[model samples]
Target: MNSLKLPDIAAQKLLHVTPLDWVGMCAIALPIQLEGRHVAAMADAGVNLVDGKSRGIHMSRLYLALEQLEHQALTPLAIHQLLADFLASHEGLSTAAHLRLSFEHLLKRPALVSPLAGWKSYQVSVDARLENEMFHVELSVRVPYSSTCPCSAALARQLIQRQFEADFSGEVLNRESVLAWLGSSQGIVATPHSQRSQASVQLRLRNNLDTVPVTELIDAVEASLGTAVQTAVKRADEQAFALANGQNLMFCEDAARRIHQALRELDIATAFTLRVEHAESLHAHDAVASSQWQW
Candidate 1:
């Protein structure tokens, strides 16, 4: 039996038709392949509704074109092709297309001093836009690390010295005594406050790359910060992490500069912006710093 004709509200023309800058679906749940594994992702697919005369854009067509991305590996070529498909599907209705996918990129990471390894999740975003036949791509990642305040370290050292003087008052300092005291809790009384921090980086990838350099970018940010938060850790690994934090003391400004310098050396990035947030334990408010280059 033929289905009864239904009213089509989407196709109904308005009395005053006006153009929309952007119109489409957002936060759509979809499974996408990244690298060789399947990862669940959310996509924001849309196009510029430039056809004012038309009642509205064919939203289902835009969605169908985006559905093709479900089976394809997420890459620069795939993203560019998907955007082209978006425009092609819109035909005369759209002059620009944009797609954004957000997902967690997981990688296996080895402990600093242990044989154990564990999976690490990185918040990743792949954004692409095609306007006037010009294509562009951007990659963003969030990395967590440890930040030790330099000022706190200095204050802690001062307190430790005073404690040591009180413990060994009017006594000649001896090597064995000092060593014993250093090994004991009394010898190392004060500790600098260190807190968890994160660096959020966005890079305008050069069009010459075959795929996103997610590992390289994460490595650079970790290297710059120097005390990346760990997954699996033995006692030795914990000690090593503590030592790293002590050696890599930094303020928020310092963290920002380090990340900025590291990203500047990478050739994959045509331009970049970075933000470092030190979730300060000493204060209720967090300390933050940001830097950008090449716009």
Candidate 2:
């Protein structure tokens, strides 16, 4: 019997073909270890086929190279190594390499004024590109919060004031009776409408950092917003949350500015872009605001 030879279409050079800007694969399903937990992650791996004479790249090499993610933490150094492997596998055919890994990061969050806690998930993405020996990494995270409209709150207070005056048109107001009425439903007729909102932040980080600062970024976002959505709550916790929301009432634009200033004051992120979305209860569409800072 004769030995069989496998066909290598990827190695065959085709003349006069235009080189592709990006080549390889996307949405490849894989399971990876993130900070010790096994997380299912989708990977998009690719390299630029810079050599016009090369017909194609070894796509399997890119796929196999992603296995490194499953074994190690997704850090800047790890990503750099992965990108290097991507180009090394393609050798003379590639000049630049890129990788995007997206996954949900889950954390246990305690409720306000409660002993209980539960898990909350945040959408996270890491985008890496190695071009011309300059490696760049960008991280994106989405955090859900509660946004209260300042205008609506003021309008509601006005309506409540008008009702109070009508109730005591000529009657002398007293601390005792006034407190009674205030405790009654007539004193609290309406409340400002609020809804769930999201803050989407993208940060461009400097190299030489060892680990991914995922938890730190999430903490910064929550602290800036001041009214992050709760996971588990008792009645007291719910009341505390309401009080926090009342104290930190903000519109979409307000949320964006808060995030921008908070991030700048921290001075951790090299460059950042923040966007806030308030899923308004008063409108059919969401209200959005964006801000960016770069040096």
Candidate 2 C-alpha lDDT tens digits along 1-295 = 7698988987887868888999979899988776667887788999998889888889999999998888887678889999999988888889999999888999999988879999999999989999889998998999999988999999999989998989989998889989998899989888999999999999987776777787888999899989999999999999999899999999888899999888887645689898899998999999999999883
Q: What is the lDDT of residue 199 in candidate 1?
A: 95
Superpose all Cα atoms of candidate 1 onto the true structure and report the RMSD in Å to 1 decimal.
1.8
Q: Count the backbone clashes (under 3 Å) in each candidate.
A: 0, 0
If scored against the real structure, what TM-score would every candidate get? Answer: 0.94, 0.95
lDDT by residue (tens digit), candidate 1, 56-102: 77788777887777787767888888888888888888999998989
**lDDT comparing candidate 2 with the true structure:** 0.89
Q: Which residue pairs show backbone clashes in model 1? A: none
Candidate 2 collision pairs? none
Candidate 1's clash total is: 0
